[model samples]
Target: MDTDRLPGCYRHPDRDTGITCTRCERPICPECMISASVGFQCPECVRAGSGTGHHPTANAPRTIAGGVVAADPHLVTKILIGINVLMFFVALSDPVLARELALYGLYRDYFGGTLHGVSTGEYYRLLTSAFLHTEWWHIAGNMLALWVIGGPLEAALGRVRYLAVFLLSGLGGSALVYLLTEPNVATLGASGAVFGLLGATVVLAKRLRYEMRPVITMVVLMLVLTFVPLGGSLSVSWQAHVGGLITGALVGLGMLMPAAGRNRALVQWGTCGVAFLLAAMVIALRTAELT
Candidate 1:
């Protein structure tokens, strides 16, 4: 037990050692001792000291299954709704702003009138139209949907991802309208982004293992109502709905994929980036077709 004539290593009884484990104070040779912040520790002490049941071999770092979660105040959704409300008031003061922001079916229709203006090739209309609404009821319905869908999505996917899905899905919807419908028609609303949330909700429902038939049923009914030609003059842009739905679902699927990096947060953001890129590719292909 004396330092002058140290005891033999417990692991190798034939070898004499002076070093001892920091935690358990056991006699350990250099080969068996692991370096720690305080002092050297034996393999058993290292394993026992770790509370997470993770085993780290010599020269290897510990592996963790989880990382810190961010606190989301649901700021993105609130900000979006605020911007939409402010734009609505501005449009009320000047009616021409609404016409300027609306997405035209034809690439050529770009003037300051309803759908009859000259085509100005204003490509930004694809995204701008999503923020513009026609009437009080139109905005109210969309804002309600955003509140319901955006909060949970922001919590689950974080603010950046939720925003990406909204914008990309909106773009997807606009691209669809640009491709299918007549150019003379004009469409305005956040229905595309709202429908994107619906599609994402469907995927989240499946992943979260909740019964989604009611949501599905509602979606189907809405699709039917949108496409079915009514005897009246009321019009709905079914193309936006279909486009947003498909894009959101794809992005959700990407989220479900097993993440690939040591940093969980980085991997999540990367997944969202890939999803956005895919959506952009879809829009690019559609644009190529249109050209």
Candidate 2:
């Protein structure tokens, strides 16, 4: 067998390298071989394999139970944004209809009132209200915020944890609104959840010891925008925004808590339990005062 006939490394053409990349099976020279944590791979192979690669193979394709592949391929944030957009269109088509189905129920139908049936309860509103926005602008604003903050946070925290933060924050926001506002007023929007995402970003930045200037600036600007009177139109729910912000900060703190020497699951569960208890208390107190 003529060794000279063997394929040479892509980087070192002079060397007759016989070893092929585990992924692409392309011959590579010692100079071109990059040692990964798992195995030896060529620069081209690694570059085209994963993590800034032209063709990533190391990243697994996400699949649901029963082997059903996801369509969007992102996760909770995209799904949430999609739902909000769809609801926005629905609301735009018929404001009255959208309100009757989702927004109006946030107060009269979900809270304590004549329309509060078995299906319509305060417990459900905590989750449902987050999906129900009043108008196109309402959903668009929230979705824009979600797109800005939700993707990075979700990617950092993972899907399940990200979902927990979003849902809990939304619930916490709604609970606060229900506690503070009059029962006659109908409240609906994803602003609470979006605020929660903002809070999470702040916490994450702090934990990572990254620069906090940008995050602080955004938070301050958001607060100013919410409170400052614009054209004498005070239709925004500052309470919900505040509530979501608080919930997100708390959740982010929970995530940052030291899990090194302690049981991670226990700490997470305990934190979540406390958050839910607090939300429940707020809801209960508000319901009592309203009725």
Candidate 3:
């Protein structure tokens, strides 16, 4: 080991580390380093001789949050952005699509037709609305935020967990909007999910022991923007933003917290389950009220 200049982790090339695997002598990051009798060993070395009576297989890399490292770490983020953009274009082609998808408790369309809503068993709108954007600037802003925040988040949490947080956050936001907003008022945008990512970013920064000022500042600024009325007619749903932020923070805590080896996945998904349960409860209560 060079005392002057430490090498980067072999598993995570960008992470500089002073620790080396006792077995392979490869530099390992804190996440990849497993404590051994003599010193720290890489995951491969630990698994090879675990006495499972199985042959040693190749080491599959993992992210900081115990997620399988994919060849393209940002795949999920890209897919989400793509879906939002695609939906935007599709909505532009057919205005009816927006009316059908946007979240609302109940409403009447311009043609005097009664538009079915969440209260009328049109529950799919909760999710569809998150991807629906009527304005180019709205989609652009949300997608840009998604790319900036989501790429790193996806890399850290991996595909499955990252996707879970994004979706649950969106649902949480919808749940809040349904509970608080006027029944006939329509609301739609990706801001809920984007705000959720911002919340997760705060957790990530905290977990990694990074400076909190910038992350906190960003969150406050976004929240402020959410409340500030844009020309009175264009009002951002602060309820959705607040709901998503809180949900993301809770879910991020579950996903990022250190847990016992066998129970890590259990703990992570359990948090997601709890979040979904709360959102479901909110929806149920609101639906009961509307009906």
Candidate 4:
């Protein structure tokens, strides 16, 4: 605090100065001072200041984007919901479009012979069906579940892996329906992906050492409601739900496994990739059998 004992400039010894950095209280010369609303800070202190003044979330992982420190708010989930909502309107406006988009089971071959009840011509329907909803309530219910689970899972798994989980889960659901159900039964909705997220949450919660009783309870209730025949007009495709849950649980095991010396993120991606490829291969084989 005494000027007499004040040291010379940090960068130069000849020039003496009394100015000090407000943050670290280090002596700084005029040339080294960076003026601010509160006071002047040294070049070093200014460089390290929390740019926003307010601190970020405690213990939250930090990501840098556009030269700014920010927390990933899981925008992927919202984007997915937006896509589904948009598709819902499109499907609602044209009811015939929904049938074309739906994953119709492969019940018979082109020649009307037994073909494991799976369709062959419209293989793309497997993935497209997951995005289509029958009506307002259909999209609303799926989006509600997605809103609840998607953000947190995306935050935990990151955008790419989160997308893998949803998409692969949806494919798993459709693949199961195509292989197991009759061609007459048509299925569509994001329920399979929502169930997949639910299943992944169970695995993730267990790994994080958190209380999973609430999550498990919700799982049971959802599964029960899924199979319990909500109304005569609607048929619940339990096969797809089960398939998606199983796929999600498997993917979560790889994604949340204990880390070793290897680059674990890469390993997680590999795991998801292999699962996706396997789903695709299976769908291809199922469709191929018809021809």
Candidate 5:
């Protein structure tokens, strides 16, 4: 038998493995392989053969998207909030650093120095901008929204999927802003990521058969407010909010709408990848236009 030609894991088709379940002969990855009396068995075989007689699902802890249940469901959310807060403080202390990290296509600072943007290949700003804020109220509102919306989402999608959705949403927002807004305008904040969690919340609520009116109402209100211009220097990027909201909703559908016993993980991550690819293409097009 050609080891290279061996089939991938039954549970994770992306992972190639030579090992097979001793009883069922099904290929399984390291994570799914359980040691039996004579040889390794897949999770299904072990669950079926368990003397305790509990159901297969009852024996294994899994999240809504089929990830392992973590001891701290909100660990990733806390870390994200902490990073944002820390970056906020750093931006406050060193104003120059904030200018460097903000999302912009291209601009010249007050000092008349030419500051590059995604157009000039300073692409890190696309993600880093999501972690930075200069105004106290800006960070406060975003962090509050994140904690309220992100906690439950992290619990539902698990850390990996939740993180992927978040980052792609942020990138989507930045990409849209670059494509639509003026090159000189600077945008910053985690509003994109927070809006993503909001979108995911709606999807989860619908999937669990929870009432949808309140969620829909909240989404509508926020979206409406995005278009309302604030007088003076204060302004909202409706582009970012819309972009993040749509990206999050699509990702949530991918993660939650799959049937059980299907390749749920693959579908979930593939959706995330598609979201990223769309964002990247937008960025590339905008970069070409700006440069």
Candidate 6:
């Protein structure tokens, strides 16, 4: 056999060729080839797969429920943080804009009083209020907590569930504020939801057998600070914090429930449904009273 006439392996300089890895074009030995329905692929080539070309095995990308494609697990947290940062800039754009957008009940009397019961098409404010903050420090503190607590919680519970916790907690906070305070009052900030995350930490800590002391202490401190009335601003909504904490605690408990303990999915969903219904009821009642 003339060595010069032998086909060289595509990936290896010294090796003479067998058949190519139809997909990657790398040379494959007989022993390396794995048999499939259509053809054979080398172990290395199969492991280092390609999108197009001769595929030994046809495998489609897998999808989960809700048509969600798998992606980097951290993507949700990153996107949330980015949105918060963007909203912060938007809130800081003009003094008037900030007052109007930032959640404040009666503290900013003009903005709050004028907008209250006026149907200014600001219904989305309940949701947006979670993203807006009074100052850089407020945003920074919440973001830091989100990064620290959210990263681990999301990793443990998964993105969908983590998002549920955040959104529901925010809604719970808003609902509490709506129920307890005057409509003329406005409240803003992620603190309520962040506090809910703290509540989650407490539950998770218990589940994982981690010390609950730190979480409890932190929660206590947060509650204390919330009531301290920073800079004589009675604008802060303690009711929101309380509601968020309750919601987060319940959600965390649901997450911590054992898989073997009877249809955890149904239980979680039911809990969420109840919370949503309660929030809706509060909103309806308040709107009715206002009207």
Give the per-residue lDDT digits (tens) of candidate 5, residues 114-231.
6688798999999999898888777888899899889878876778888988998898888888899998888998988788778887887787555478799999998997888754
- List, residue by residue over 11-127, the lDDT tens digit for candidate 6: 444534345555666664322333333344555544455444656334322111111222454566777888889888887776567666654333424544544322333556666
What lDDT tens digits, residue by residue, belong to model 2 across residues 33-98? 444434346555554556664344343331110011233324778899889878767766887655
The CA-based lDDT of model 6 is what? 0.65
Candidate 2: Cα lDDT at 281: 87
RMSD of 1: 16.4
Tens digits of per-residue lDDT, candidate 4, 164-225, equal: 88998998888887767766777888888888888887886676445567789999998998
Best of the two (5, 6) by TM-score: 5
Query: Which prediction has more favorable TM-score, 4 or 6?
Result: 4
Ranked by TM-score, top first: 3, 5, 4, 2, 6, 1
Candidate 3 vs candidate 4: which has greater lDDT?
Answer: 3
Q: Please state every model's RMSD to the true fold in angstroms.
A: 16.4, 12.0, 5.0, 14.4, 12.1, 13.9
- lDDT (0-100) at residue 185 of candidate 6? 61
Best by lDDT: 3
- Candidate 6 similarity to native, TM-score: 0.67
Please tell me which predicted candidate would have the highest TM-score against the true structure: 3
Residue 195 lDDT in model 2? 92
Ranking, lDDT, top scorer first: 3, 5, 4, 1, 2, 6
lDDT of each: 0.67, 0.66, 0.83, 0.70, 0.81, 0.65
Q: Write the per-residue lDDT of candidate 3 for residues 1-291, one digit (tens) a residue.
A: 657555777988876656678788999764565445455567677767665664433233556677876768799999999999999999889988888999999776757787578989999999999998878778888999999999888877889999999999999999999999998998899899889888987987787555578789999899888877765334688988999999999999998875436687999999999999999999999999988
- List TM-scores for all candidates, in order: 0.64, 0.68, 0.81, 0.70, 0.78, 0.67
Q: Give the per-residue Cα lDDT of candidate 2 at 187.
A: 76
Q: Write the per-residue lDDT of candidate 1 for residues 216-250, one digit (tens) a residue.
A: 99788867877866443226789998988887777
